[model samples]
Target: MVGIVKYNMAKISGKVVSVLAKRGPGSGGTYPGHIFTKIGGQESISKLASDLKIGSVLITGTNGKTTTTTLLIKLMSNDIQIRKSYENNILNSIATALLTQKGDMGIFEYGIRNLTYGIPDTVQKLIDPIGVVYTTISQEHTQVAGIKNPFEDYYKAKKLLSEGMQRGAIVTNADDPRTALIGLNKASDVNINYYGIEVDNVEDIGGEDIECPKCGQPLSYSKHFLNHRGVYTCQCGFKRPEPDVKLVNAEFNTDSWKLTIEGDLFNYTTSQNVKFNVVLSVPPFGFHNIYNTLASITAYATFTPKVENIESTVKEIFNNLDMSFIPPGRFEVVDIGGKYVGLGQGDNGDAIKINAMFMNQFVDGPLEFIYTTPDENEEEIFNDHFEVVKSMNPAHVIVVPGRKSIEKAKEYYEIIKKEYPDAEFYPLSYDEMGVRIEKLTELARDSDYDYVIMTGCGEEQAMWEEIKKKMINR
Candidate 1:
């Protein structure tokens, strides 16, 4: 076994290139050093995978992975010295668990885009994970692996996640088709747990009928709320089973980041995504902070069943959530001489979609927006942020252009003049930006426009800090 593992690790290693020549035509593809490193490391890795019960829970699917994983970690971290990991898509807690003595429980997440990065082989080991959570399904990486059927793609990845689960449980969104389809037959021998909102039974959004050892078929409606979940019926007929449970209902308030499930309310902080109805909210992400919190509740409640500790842990997290989740841009308020400003990147379209676009949540009346960018040519940068600028409806949109930025600002001013001819666009000189910012603060005071937004990169927080200090000192 040792020889086979070493040989397999080497077959795809970089040593083949060194043997080809010290300097070869396609040498960039693999380095001989990488081969040596990987070969030398296999022994330690195998031992790590085998020695104990490293409870791992892989959070996958598109949307709620971050929210769910974050909340799950929050619930378990207080008592169990849990380890975590991230792979761009989701935190890779498995990696964190392997590196720490305290990490007896590994709760990690992964980003999958079909064949391009099929589920990693480590997750398929029978004893690998004691738990798992699937957030939801949507076209996260449609073009990556050429998966024509979204549901089928979801099933394949799910099956791989549950492949070796002999002892631990598999948790799926009982409401999402992507997860619900991975039924008991998928892994009859392993433990399986299903969770959906109580509202789903009422709304008829989740679950279906089966002999569903867990729930019956024809999948009669208990209730359904956001997506698919609720009471279900089967030919054999079953309804929500005991112990491995279902939440009664959920209400999420985006503005305050408050979540209420089964009449038990929890307040989340700004860092919490409000659309946290895990299985219902899909990829690219929506503000489901509440759903994410609830999913954590469900996952912990269903698998662990140490109800008292789990419930107490959740209450503890909520108590600490407010302090941990606020002041995302490092502070909550940005002020300058009696006026306050909000900094923005305006680059992440999803936030805008939820906050401004669909929600019609833009501010009313005169406000100032200082948009900056590296497009030295101000005209390009101005044009680039045109949509956001237009959306801000600034009383006087100031383009703090960099070197070579005036042309762009002038172009925008001309364009704005053609319609709201009274509205103006000002291009501030690079050397006098601080002076210009002060001038804007004075204008804000004179005009009674108390709210300002500084949009761009890196400069937002610093400028806001100065603005706050100026306002305080004034």
Candidate 2:
């Protein structure tokens, strides 16, 4: 119910708002997109996107969407006019793409929250992505997925991305049994490309209990990597698909790692001899990112045309990249007056578990844990994460209240007290940013604590900014 000229005007206004918002106080990332969605709606946005010549590439999953999207953008050839939005919001993504429309290709990270209805209603109809990458599936978004039987709801919701994908290529992780099944179910209709990490002595641990999609039977795994992801087999004849793109013979070190990526398409060996100057949330850099790296490389390889030697092609594509680049807030490490502090921003319980275990490993001595959540509904997830953090036997633990909910803070405190009676608990309350920085600074000053590790499901960016600002001043 909108005219072309009106839509254009709305888009311009949205961009202006975005620019103004960015220059002002807060991150203007999602505001412009929100304005565009509110004013123009999906119909106008879709009409505007119809002019895209190169098609779109959608990246969506529980974790690694931003990192994967960023890597994919870097791996892709420069000539492709790829439009991407860092915002995970659907409206923001649509607006950003329409405003910045260029090149033949569009790359977007569609958040998992929008999978059920957002994909079918907006992305499928608008971007009509020729290619899609699903990073991994975990039970997240409890409110959206419903409280009871949330896993099934989350799984089905995530599958909507593939179902809505334009019959081109859908790349997924082979080790992630849930997403692998989603790809297999669609293999008959779509080009399902699978990629995963292949390593020896990979134990199945700390993953959701995976069940067969076909039958409600429990799945078995020879090697479970993280959570339910591994070489899974079911009695209903569902099994993990062999990856078309695989990173084999992977090895990790304290400062560096090595990868030998092999598949039907490409055979390449790459090593991180020089530490990338950042500590990833998944430490040793091989735990989770290896999968993300393989997925990105494999997805890009498929997107690119037939190359007889994918190894050379990969080297050529990524040769110019700053290998030192770190995705913001994943596992961001900062020095606050010579004290090494790391931030592990987990998006879900599994992510929390993964990062907690890694952070526990990489720390030299006496690690301090700071935990925060933004929503009360995430208490169950918080409990799961707190259990993992507790298992790490941190030197001290700080339970910060959620953004606006003190009640949830109290609940989190109870969980900590009930589980770890003797563990040190600091229920410090900071109402202002300055107060938070001051309190955290005081804690860092203590030589007793080796390093402070902050883990938050939400409110990571705000905390990360505060910590960075403190470091800058120090």
lDDT of each: 0.47, 0.65
Query: Per-residue lDDT for 354 in model 1?
Result: 23
Q: What ranges in model 1 sit over 4 Å off? A: 3-37, 40-46, 52-54, 87-93, 145-155, 183-187, 199-287, 303-306, 323-474
Q: Write the per-residue lDDT of candidate 2 for residues 344-410, one digit (tens) a residue.
A: 4675777777776566555777777777654567666776777677677777777666445567776
Task: List residue ranges in candidate 2 displaced over 4 A.
Answer: 1-41, 77-79, 114-121, 144-149, 201-208, 265-286, 305-313, 316-324, 334-339, 373-375, 422-434, 444-447
Task: List, residue by residue over 164-193, the lDDT tens digit for candidate 1.
Answer: 567566666665544665545555665555
* Model 1 TM-score relative to the real fold: 0.52
Worst 10 residues of 1 by lDDT: 266-275
